[model samples]
Target chain A: MPSSPSNQSYHHGSLRAALLSHAMELLDTKGIEGVSIRAVARLAGVAHSAPANHFPNKRSLMSALAARIFNQLENEVLAQMETTSGQRAERVMAFAEAVVAFALTYPHRYRLLWRRESLIDHDAELHSAMEAVYALLIGTIEGEDDEFTTSLETRAIAIWSMVHGYLIMRLDGNLMEKTDELTQAPRHRAIITALLEGIGGGPSGARRDC
Target chain B: MPSSPSNQSYHHGSLRAALLSHAMELLDTKGIEGVSIRAVARLAGVAHSAPANHFPNKRSLMSALAARIFNQLENEVLAQMETTSGQRAERVMAFAEAVVAFALTYPHRYRLLWRRESLIDHDAELHSAMEAVYALLIGTIEGEDDEFTTSLETRAIAIWSMVHGYLIMRLDGNLMEKTDELTQAPRHRAIITALLEGIGGGPSGARRDC
Candidate 1:
C-alpha cells in the first residue's frame, strides 16, 4: 500500500511542504524577522542545503509562504461563503467575519501577506488569488441589487477598506475599551450591517439612488 | 541670556531628543529592525550609554517614538482641520486627506505607529494622544449636525476604519490598478464623501435613514 503524503518520510516532494510548515511556525512565534532559510531547514530536521533546493533564496521562500497564505485565505473565505445562507449583506458579513477571524488568529501571516517588501516582485499567483477574493466580494455586493449606484470597483474598494481597517484595529487593540461589546459576533454583525446599511447596500431596506 | 532649548548643544538635557531624532532617521531608512540604541547613539554622536540614560531599554525608546508620532499626527490633522473651509462633509474629507497624504509620504513611520509589538505597554501618553485624534474625528463628524441619529463613537469608528483602511491599502498597492485616480486628492475626497454620505453623514446629498 502507498503511504499517505502526511505519513511519507521526507523527500523532494514533501520537503517543500515540510519547510513551509516549519517556516509558518517560526513566523507565528518570532514574526517575519525570525523566518530564515537556515532556521526553517533546522526546524524541518533537513540538511542546510535542502531548503535552498526548493526555494533558492530567502525572498523565494517568503514569496512561497505568502502565496500559500493567499491560497489558504481564498479557501477559508470561499468555505464561509458557501455555508452562508441569507441576504446578500448577511453573506458578505459572514465572509468578512471569517476573514477577521483568520487575521486575528494569525496576525503575523496576514501582515506578511501584505508586506510591500515581500510582495515587491508582484507574484502572479498571489495577485490572482487576491483578485479572486475581490471578485467574490464584488459579486456578493452586486448580487444584492438589480442596480448598484456606485461602480462595482468603487464599492468593492470601499467595503474592503472598511472591513480590513476594522480587523486591523481590532487586532491591534485600537478599538475603544467601551467597545468590548463589539468583540461579540452578534454585536459585530450589527455593526457591519449598520455600516452596509449606511451605504444602502445591506439589509437595512434603504435603496441608494442609481 | 539663557540659551534657547532649540539652540542647546548635545548635553544631558538635549540628549533624549537628539537620540530620538537620529532614531527616526534610522526608522525611515532601515525600518524598526534597523533601529538600535547603539545605532541611534552612533548617529547622534553621543556616548553609547546616553540612550540608555533616557530610554532605559529599547521598548521605552520605541514607546517614546510612538507617542511622538501620535503627537505629530494630532497636530497635522488639527492643522488641516483649521485651514479647511466648507460644509461638514468637505471638512471631514480634508481631515482624511491629510491622514492619507501623511501615510503615503512616510509609510514606514505610519506603519510603526500601528504595530502592536512596538506598543505593548499601553503607554498613557500615547493613549491620550491617540484619543485626542479620535476626539478630533468625532468632533468633525458631530459638528455637521446638531441632531445626528448615529452615536458619535460609532460614526467615528466607521469613518476612521474606512479612511485608515484606504490609506494602508493605497500604501501597499493593494487597491485595483484601475482606481489609480484615487491617488489624487480630488478622487480621494469624492470617495470619502461618498462613504460618509453612505453612512448618512457626508455631503453626498444622500442622507441615510437615521
Candidate 2:
C-alpha cells in the first residue's frame, strides 16, 4: 500500500513545512519571481506534484509563506513589547524598532509580504496573521490619547505609516542614515520620539509662499 | 547630405521627447519590466537602433525617465505650495498632499523613481532633481521649530517617511480607509494633522509589562 513504511515519505505535516522552508530559501536568493510551486517542490526533493497537496498553486504557496513570515513579525513585535520597560509609547516605539530590525534582516521576505497581488491575500490564515500585528498597534494607541484629539485609528495610522515608510525608504535606498540631531539616540528612535512629542514648528516671520 | 529633411527624421530633441513618451506609456501599461531599449524604440516607430542615440542603454533611459518624472513631481509640489494659503504647516501638508495625488495618478511612474538599482541614480540630473524635492521640505521646516526641539532634518524625515509609507501601504493594499474617529477630514488629512499636532497618548493605567 502507499501507506506502507517505506512509502509513507516524510510525515504529511513536515513535508509542508519542508516545502515552505525551501520556498523561503528561494525567495531569499532570487526574490518573488524566483519562487514557484515546481521550484519549491524540486528544492524539497519531492516530485513536483507533491507540493500540490499543500498548495494547489503558486499564489496559495506565497500566501502561506506570507502568513508564516507575518506571524514571525508578530512574534517579534510581541517579544519586544514583552521585554521593553517604559511608557506605552516606549513599548510602541519598541514595536517599530523590532519591525525595522526584522525588515532589514529579511528584506526580501518583508517585501513579499506587501506584494498582495501575488498572494491569495484573502486566505483566512494570511488575513489573521497580518491583522494580528495591525491589531497590536491599534491596541497600543487605544485610550492613551491625552494631548491630541485625533481619532485612535488615525493615531495608529500615523505611527504605522511613519514606521513603514521609513523602513521601506531605507530598504529602497531612497533614504539614508544621518546622525540624529535632537538626541544621541538612533535616527529612527529620534524620529519615533518626534512622532510622540510632535515636531511642532512654523514660519517665524510673515507666511509668504513657502 | 545626412542633414537633409527626409534623412533627418524627427529632430534630435523632439525625438528624445517622443521616445520618452512612448516609454512612459509602456511603463504605465506593463511596469518597469516592460521597458527596454528595443521595446521603447519600436513603440516610438523609430528603427530599433534609434533610442541608442540618446540612451546608451536601458539604464540610462530609465534614469532619464526617472529624472523627468521627479521634475514633474517637483512641479506639482511647487504648484500646491504656490496655491495653498494658511500656516506653514498647512503649506507643508499641501506638499505631502500633492505627492500623494501625483503618486495615485501615476503609480507606476512614482514607483519607478525609487528603483535606484535599475537607474543610474548618481547621474547629475537625476540626483539634483531628487534633491530639489528634499531641499524644499527642509527649507519649509527650517525656522519653524518653535515648539519641539527636534532637528530640521529629523522633522522633514518624519513627515516625508509617513507620506511615502502611507501611500505605498495604500498602493500595496496593506492598509485601507476607515472613517476618521477624530474629525470629518479625509483619513489622509487627519493623519497628516496628527503628524503635525502629535498623537499624544499614554496607557491610562500603571506601567506594567505591556
User: What is the TM-score of each candidate's chain B when compared with the real chain B?
Assistant: 0.80, 0.81
TM-score versus the correct structure, for each prediction: 0.82, 0.80
lDDT of 2 at A135: 91
Model 2 over residues B1-210: C-alpha lDDT tens digits? 333323444654466777888899998998777787788878766788978888888889999999999999999998888887677678778888899899888988887886655788468888889889988777666664344545567778898988887787676656463342333325677677777666554322232210
Q: After superposition, how far is residue A89 of candidate 2 from its true place, in Å?
A: 1.5
Query: Number of the top candidate by TM-score?
Result: 1
* Model 2 CA lDDT for position A2: 32
DockQ of each: 0.31, 0.33
Q: Which candidate number has the best lDDT?
A: 2
Best by DockQ: 2
lDDT of 2 by residue, A74-170 (tens): 9998888888767777777888888988998898888888776578846889988988999988866665534454666677878989998777667
Error of 1 at A74 (Å): 1.2
